[model samples]
Target: MNLLLLKLTLIPTIVALVTLAIRKWGGKIGGLIGSMPWVAGAILLFFILEQGKAFGIQSIQGSMTGIMALITFCLSYAIFARKFTWLPTLLIAYVLYTLTAVVFDYLRLNLMLSYVLVLSYVVLTLYLFPSPTAPPADGRRLPFDIPIRMGVATLFVLIITGLAHVLGPNWSGILTPFPILTSVLAIFSHTLQGSNAAIVTLRGLVMGLLGFTTFLYLQAHWLPEFSVATSFGMAVVINAFINVVVGKIW
Candidate 1:
């Protein structure tokens, strides 16, 4: 791993471990180690954003890499968190690796009205799910959520970017991104933070992404052929997964 990822992954581990140890030992040890994750995550978050200008991130490739790092680093802690279970976390990681490979393509797209529309829908849909009760980095949302929201916004941008990149300029119609089946899992990830939701979201995203993408691939579909109706249909499938995966069908 590079220096940034090292910081992003290691610091959080150190902090969480130190904090927990202090409870058993003393506060001093906890104070030192516990400071690492938050401070590291914050600093690293800024650094990742900064890389955009360091080498002229105006390019899609850089932006895509940046987005990959943004989401990857944010979700890194989940690697150690109890939320992940089953074989699919590995699957999502692999698929995400594939998605990461396309970041450059994602970066190339123009941020047009279509971009705004997709993002608005993702955010709105995410809102419908809401976050589940859990310790919110000290029992409340804070500056911490800034990066989280920023990362998700980047995803919205990505979804839009991905959509526009796949479809051409003249062919405008309601088309979903990869697959709507995974959309609810994205929402569930936002709201719930437990072994159950964690397991479902992780596995569901993988299953859903695979299922939806496979179907799209079979259609021999490219960007221009995608329409808005297809997008909605995909989203419905994603929600169907959420229903089974999270018992949120109602």
Candidate 2:
């Protein structure tokens, strides 16, 4: 298989499918599904395959930091969405996300500490996330919505992977959780459906971060001791299981 071709097509396909699912199931479930490690998972696999498993494992610590930044992005977006439109809300959230990422990268926390701190933060954020007053309104669908999403998301991965050499494993990992997908969903929802819809979607994305964090943490441990296939497969299952449990309770 051509790894490059897979890299180009896989994320868009996943994003397309996730978009369709969101349309079908509504914001929360769609956001949860979107929150899965679709982008980061693929990026890490490529790192392991091209760079080395050791590099991939080392990058997971950075990914933990990325996850924290992601949480801030979603939480801030939800908060700002209450008063502002998508553009301003996204800008504010992005600034906060970048600040969090930079500070955490400087701290250079270990995998275990990053993992614990991220999980603890996820719990606290979930408790604090805004609840939609009502379900999302069914606004008219945007033309080429899914295609645009797929393009933007695939572009982010391509640019990041293209620059992985320059950025190195730690920076690449730190960027793995950047809010491309989250922004797309939030902007569309905020524009078409309204602020509450975006809030619901972002909150659900944060909820999925619980499992997303676990997946990255597990890969750091398992990738060192197991084959890439076996390690990723186990992480996928565990991530799904964690999301399932969290979904049922939250």
Candidate 3:
């Protein structure tokens, strides 16, 4: 099978499952699962397969820096969701995410430094993340919701992977956590439920990034010395362990 076709098919299926899981478990769990490196990991895997191990390594480093942008995005959206409607909130958050990505793109740092910088921002964002004002009201599910979510996920993966060669590892890595799933979840939650729902979802995403950070850090160091399967497997195990610890603490 063609690799891109495989991505288009497999990723959307995973998105659909996660979407269903979100609905089943509630916004916070949804956010937690959603924040996992489903899309980002898949993209990086494709990079390794199609481009080369060296490219994947550089991309992982770039991805660590890009994570800061995701933290900013969730923080911005969480803050704005409390005051503004979904549309304006999304717009402002997207602008901030874009600008932050641009800034991170130019700043050169080794993997350890990037991890430290990102962790600082992550801690700060978690501290600043808005408390949910109220529980989210249940929204009526649309039949097409899953399909729409899948479509959006497919589109994003296609665009990113298609441009991987052109963007190179750095820019591609920067774009990895582009908030496609989070945006979809937030917008839908806001439109259907309310601002509080959106806030909860974004907070979940922010909290979930703890595991994501671990995943990328492991990948950056492990992929060169280990088989891809072994590297990802270990990363997932570590990520799940962190998620459990985070769940207990937070």
- After superposition, candidate 2 runs with Cα above 4 Å error: none
Across 45-88, the per-residue lDDT of candidate 1 in tens digits comes to: 23324342221112222322322322332233235234544335
Tens-digit lDDT track of model 2 for 104-181: 999988889888999999999999998888778887788898899899989988888888888898998998888878
Cα misplacement distance, residue 108 of candidate 1 (Å):
0.8
TM-score of each: 0.28, 0.97, 0.96
Worst 10 residues of 2 by lDDT: 133-142
Ordered by TM-score, highest first, the candidates read: 2, 3, 1
Instruction: Assess each prediction's global lDDT (C-alpha) against the native.
Output: 0.33, 0.88, 0.86
Q: Between 1 and 2, whose TM-score is larger?
A: 2
Query: Which candidate leads in lDDT?
Result: 2
lDDT at residue 194 of model 2 (Cα atoms): 90
lDDT of 1 at 113: 32
| Model 3 residue 221 distance off true place after TM-score fit, in angstroms | 1.0
The model with the greatest TM-score is 2
Q: lDDT rank, highest first?
A: 2, 3, 1
Q: Distance from true position, residue 14, model 2, in Å? A: 0.6
Error of 2 at 180 (Å): 2.0
